[model samples]
Target: MENNKQPQLINPAELFNPEPYGFSHSISVKSPFQMCFISGQSGGEGENHVLTDDFKMQVQNALKNLKIVLQSHSMTFENIVKITLLIVDHNQEKLEIWVAEAKKVWKGTFLPTSTLIPVSQLALPGMLFEIDAIAVK
Candidate 1:
């Protein structure tokens, strides 16, 4: 795909640079590209959909699941323009883990815009983290 069709990550001078946190302030996408909206993915696995209790594992698994969906469309993390993260019992430690996992997925300068929402619970028990993404190509 052409570079112009990719999402443009922007962190304005007036706004705080969110790169240290593993995201951008905003993203701009051009036309002549297809858009993909993925549903929230959690740490659950297998036919029974069992979720792991470990917070870091959950975060990793969630990102892995997101990647599975992206690959189904022949896209990668670089194609993602935005993501929404849900963390159960959010805290500094959990945030750090999430950022670390996100950095592993998005290694380049173009990080996706993200919104993190902390909640008491998720769709499934033992689910500690979830992530949904929007991608363009």
Candidate 2:
């Protein structure tokens, strides 16, 4: 039987609220649908497979790549339940940029739960940002 109960959102008083950043502190989901975990996407294009140097550009391309993956699997942004964002040399400015870009793609649907990680480097060189996602149907 499919569980009809929805996941409860929790934001502890001790922790700061992160709703403005296009995500929540924590979320729970109890569903009977299949869950899809998409691998981290990069910012590369064409035959040369060149990664973008600009942070904003990379952010956009990475999201575009993610969209391709979602569509390929017969899903869309609304199906996403969680996300993990990794940014190189992260800072408040970069975070602001990220949130702006994220808001563009996830303009609606209450924004999915997310986690942001500041990392010094990624698996591939010259990758400014990467995003992985989890979606449930």
Pick the TM-score winner: 1
lDDT of 1 by residue, 9-124 (tens): 54434333446656653454567776777767778765455677899987877776677667666679999998999988999999999888888889999999999999999876
**Could you report the Cα RMSD, in angstroms, for every candidate shown?**
11.7, 11.9
| Candidate 2, 9-80: lDDT as tens digits | 543333334365455433444456655666676676543447878999889887877786676556788889
Candidate that scores best on lDDT: 1
- Whole-model Cα lDDT of every candidate shown, in order: 0.76, 0.74
- What's the lDDT of the predicted structure labeled candidate 1? 0.76
lDDT measured at residue 18 in model 1 versus the true structure, 0 to 100: 43
Query: Which stretches in model 2 have alpha-carbon errors above 4 Å?
Result: 1-31
Q: Model 1, which residues run further than 4 Å from truth?
A: 1-31
* TM-score, cand. 1 vs. native: 0.76
